[model samples]
Target: MKHDRPKISDVARLAGVSTATVSRALSAPERVSEETRAAVQQAVEATGYRLNLAARNLRHRRTGGIVALVPNLANPFFSQILSGIASVLGPAGYNLLIADTRTADAQTLLDYAEPSRADGLIILDGTLPATALQGRVPVVEACEWVPGLPAPRVKIDNRAAAGLAIGHLADLGHRRIGHVAGPRGNVLTEARLSGTAEALAARGLPFPEEHLYPGDFSLDSGREAARIWLDQPAATRPTALFLASDAMACGFIGEVQRHGLRVPGDLSVVGFDDIELVAHISPPLTTIRQPRTEIGRAAAERMLACLKGETREADTVLPVELILRASTGPAPA
Candidate 1:
């Protein structure tokens, strides 16, 4: 004959704690003392107790999971953000489901917004139309967002952050600075481009429209911008550059070297997004740190609130900081 399964009451009895205390230990251990938690854990191991997640989910009428919809899974920038999100949600016993928009077909992509798939959603793609997310599940926008989207947003002040990047370049005495722009239609690209323009004007620096090169915020785009600079006369080409993303800045730097140009000695460059790769690259990149971990944690919190029928604020904009590194220096004499 099969042995009977251990129950919650058995665990509580073994631990010498009330059933409520046992539940609390499993659900919110932080609310209990360390000694109490240890006893409950010991009781669980002794009784061979395991949580019945299916039964709990059935009773609560909820899936114990949330989905994060990222535009690109390959981009390392999203990795830290996802880690931060997991750190917050995991402690609460919620599973994280990663949905990569790039891999999904148009038909399957919209399924992410469906409430039936997960309890909530954290959308990191700004280009998706607001109408696409009209499902019943609560939604939070992180890193990027589309205007008029009703969901809560947790991100940095992109325009101001971009302005900070450019201001740093200006302070270095580089009046004739070039910019590697992001994709044309992206909200980030628009905000950063406008901010760069404003910063240049405020500094009373030169910004020839021709110097505003088109880029897709990719390594190839960065290399192309560098090639265009190479085509220009050495005396007229800008002494400094402010790339839209660290990936692009790194590409530009590598290509410039391949073409026999010295960074800082020949060209000073500043990049946006202080990604990990930026720090390890030769002559580390000076960039605006977006606090990816903070943004991710905040987004998870906001989503949790929304799921609880709370009315969260429209947007929470975190501050950005400029990280000075070996990539930037005083303008060439």
Candidate 2:
């Protein structure tokens, strides 16, 4: 004969508590006392009992799911952030659903935020319109944020980070500096570009329109920028460059080196986002380091708080650091 499956009643009996108490501890854990939760957990382990999430969710009127909206799933920069979110939500009995918003239309994004689909949302795409998310599920913005959304956001100071990059190059006696900017209409692109301008102005450095190269935070764009730079006269070229993303910086460096250029000796380059790949690249990159994992964890915590009716309207800004490497040096004489 087949043995019976372990049930809530078994857990309750083993923990010396009523089935009602066991149910609360397993489903809405915050409602139960710490001691009760611990006892129920021990009992669950002893009896090899597992929670029936479907039945519990139905009874509690919860979807037991959280959705995270990312701009690009293929980018390695988002990997650590997603991992941080999963670490917190997994133990809390919530399933994480990831959606790539890059190609998703407005309706498709709205559907993901529907009450029947997910209980909460973690948004990493700031380009989304505020109207799309108005009056939907509770949301916590991570890394990027929509302007005037009133949602709790966790991110680093993009402008300040940009300043750090420009300052580093300026201090190295590089008089002429150039910038590779992110796409227009992006929040980060605007912030970082403005910061670069401000830093240059503060130092009395010239930044003509020609010095700014358009980029989409992609390697291809960086390679294209490299081509443009190579076409310019050597006497007019900027001695140092600050790129918005590490991928673009690497692309620019690779392409220029192909034409027999040496980094820092011929031109110095700095990048934003100290991705893992940057450290291992040829002539390791100097970049601004963002606490990507911490941003995700903080966003997840804020999302959980919103779901629990402990909502706050505060924005959390994490710190960034300037990481020096072999990619930058004093300007060539």
Candidate 3:
């Protein structure tokens, strides 16, 4: 005769918790006390209760969980990206797991690849090494990545995006243009830097190395970049700044104000990654509008195809638009 399946009551009895608590610990673990949750989990594992996971997860050749890995979840820009991923996955009856690796460190990135719990991975953070991916999971490179990876990707042309930012500044008659670059050795940094150089060269302009501010894609880095720009001699200082991200641009503007400088008066600014805050902040930001949600959706679709062994294009380049706002104007005469 076939064996009857173990019940929830059996798990509760072993765990010394109410059936309700067991359910809570299993489903919404954040609601349960750590100690009790651990006990319940131990009991569930001890009983070999797969708990419908085999059927629930696609990795088990069934409907499995899919993880959307982001470097930072709190950023408002990524919130829409996550929603886009969910929008694509929810209709297919797939569960979504969101994990913020917290840091861009290689070790943390590699840790996410282990065990292959998810059938596929949508990687928003580009810091992870390609070696870490190595067939462990179906990987779709989203907005960012380390340089020189052959993995399939979905993104806008970073080089052209940077050129657009510089061109906007140049059009404002800002001859001395400064770039607050992203983190050192970052893939975005190289692409944007190259684009800035190409734009300046095409305009018969020269970009001094001193005008490149080292930033790590943070508000603090932007603040630092502003301070460095201010330190330059007034006559020779960059009349305008183009930041690599909206966060950096906000920081730069905030810092400039703290020093009693007005945006678009003392300096004309252009930023990339047209996040929501760019529109609400004082003076509003002039920025490049990235198709962030579209990128997320495209990445998800690519990963799904890879999971299904369906042949698909290796790269998809989304388009970006330039938004001119109050933050930019003619350079101060």
Candidate 4:
């Protein structure tokens, strides 16, 4: 037996709405009321009606795809952000294409921005030059952003977030604070480093050059930082350290424990990007919680706006929270 598939008219009839309303409800949900959307959904479920997305995209001259450029696809911090992006774009009938720019050159990365490839782009790599993305497809920068690119960026205030970390430590009676900074030439690294300095200055605290350690936001760099801290004379060591990333903080804590050390008892540690792993560590990490998923969602919304020819001149800055955990405590007596 052969049965013809249900059409949009069938769905409209079942929902007691016009075919035009059904089309708008399915394709651009925001254009319709909540009750209408619910009715359309029920009608769709009852009639087993499916949209012909391929044909619709062909008629509209759209590729039905959105590309996201991530610096490191393996990093857990980015997982939630990517999930958020997918949550929105998927239901909107757009395919998400994630490209890792970790080892890609400028020219190679630029190729992904062509309009023929995808309808829009979501860039999370801040290291790319402004020239690479200037006149290409519509873009929304998430988490990280190029300095001079004329695109809407969705991120937290890195400087203020760093200040929160420093303020927390200072309130806990820790006078001499140390910082594990990210690599040079990175925008986040620069912002956070400057924030650390500004916070210290505001409190009239001394940040000796030796208290600053170089890192590349990796577990290995954290381990190396632990070694450097351990080598310093006991009397001159800072009472607490604020690491640039949670992975690095975890690595430093693990390495320090291996060499017979107690967190918060002998030394306290704070980290950024409250990733999931931090909560389960030996001494749960105290860190700055970035709204990673929200950042992604906001970025996707901005991309959609750009596609609709809407202009957003201001950047979106989300709020961050300082989560207190066992990894941080008052300065040792």
lDDT tens string, model 2, 1-333?
998999999999999999999988987798999999999999999999988888878977889899999999999889999989988888888899999998899899889878999998899989888888867899889999988777899999999999999999999999889999989999999999999999999999999988899999999999999999999889988899999999999999999999999997999999999999999998999999999888878888888889878977668999999999999999999
TM-score per candidate: 0.91, 0.97, 0.80, 0.94
Q: How far does residue 287 in candidate 1 sit from its true spot (Å)?
A: 1.1
Sliding window of 10 residues with minimal summed lDDT for model 4: 103-112
Name model 1 segments beyond 4 Å from true: 1-5, 15-42
RMSD of each: 2.4, 1.3, 10.2, 1.9
Residue 252's lDDT within candidate 4 is 94
Model 4 lDDT per residue over 110-227, tens place:
7877777889989898988888777778999998889999899899999999999999999999899999999888999999999999999999889999999999899999999999
State in Å the error of residue 209, model 4. Answer: 1.3
TM-score of model 4 vs. true structure: 0.94
lDDT by residue (tens digit), candidate 1, 280-309: 887889999989999999999988788778
Candidate 4 whole-model C-alpha lDDT, 0 to 1: 0.92
Q: lDDT tens digits, residues 34-152, model 3?
A: 99988998999887664655543543464366787887787777887787888887655567788887744667666566645667778787776678766676777888864555667
Return the clash pairs for model 1, or none: none
All candidates' lDDT scores? 0.87, 0.92, 0.83, 0.92
